[model samples]
Target: MTRREAGLTLVLMDRLRTQRLPRLQAMHARVTAGDCLDAHDLRYLCVSLEETQRMKSPSIDTREAIRAVLARLYHEITTQALSNEQARFRHAAH
Candidate 1:
């Protein structure tokens, strides 16, 4: 996706994370023994989700921080990645 699209997506993701993430966490917590997620896996998801939310902060400084983070993430994912993966990251979110 383009940077504009990615920025919009990041905004939407941040809005949803505060409301949806906790519910998702609760559901996994309530799952039975048959279902399990390792610490690393869960932590990765949490961190990723947190970044999404952080990117949409009302503060300008926070937005700049998120933009930097997004650029790094975009670069990391685009070093000969699939088309879809490339479409999923933004070089610098405006």
Candidate 2:
């Protein structure tokens, strides 16, 4: 992605992360209750953990932060696509 694209991606990701906070809180509650997570839930939890780790890293230049955000966006897109496909297959099998 171009620098502008990466910057846009970061903005979108930030918005999405903000929007997802409630869902994350719900997931945390579920985990605290000792509930088991299904495959999709597990994947989301893993991605959230990865994102938290990335955000906690030492601060970098604007360009580097944009690059890191872009990488994270790509990772999330790929994982979401895979998860959708798996869900479709499971639904089809039922």
Candidate 3:
């Protein structure tokens, strides 16, 4: 890769570590704690996923690692959301 491309890759990786990863981790923790994600939180996740698709890092390992983390996050978020929906349904049926 060219020097400029390498520089961009470094910037993307740094942003992932310093900015995106922390936010994602926090969301994962919140969902794991049984808190239903709000619409804004869901929207952010969608946008983040879309942005991740657009990212072009030269490191296959880094991309795979990010994808794995995202998959886990998606799972937890959906699981919590499902639990919340079930609780609401039960509440309404009573």
Q: lDDT for each of the candidates?
A: 0.50, 0.56, 0.77
Q: In candidate 3, how many clashes are counted?
A: 0
Clashes (candidate 2): 0
When 1 and 3 are scored with TM-score, the better candidate is 3
**Span of ten consecutive residues with least summed lDDT in model 2:** 51-60
Q: After superposition, how far is residue 7 of candidate 3 from its true place, in Å?
A: 3.7
Which rank order by lDDT, best down to worst? 3, 2, 1
Tens digit of per-residue lDDT, candidate 3, span 3-94: 88778667877877798778988887877676677889889888877767756667788778878887787777778877977886888899
| TM-score pick, better of 1 and 2 | 2
* TM-score, prediction 2: 0.38
Error of 1 at 63 (Å): 0.3
Model 2, position 76: C-alpha lDDT score: 56
**lDDT tens per residue, model 2, 37-78:** 468976875676555444421235754665566456545544
Number of the top-ranking candidate, with lDDT as the measure? 3
Error of 3 at 9 (Å): 3.2
Error of 2 at 82 (Å): 24
User: What is the per-residue lDDT of model 1 for residues 13-67, given as tens digits with 9 covering 90 to 100?
Assistant: 6654575446444434433222334466457556665656544444568667756
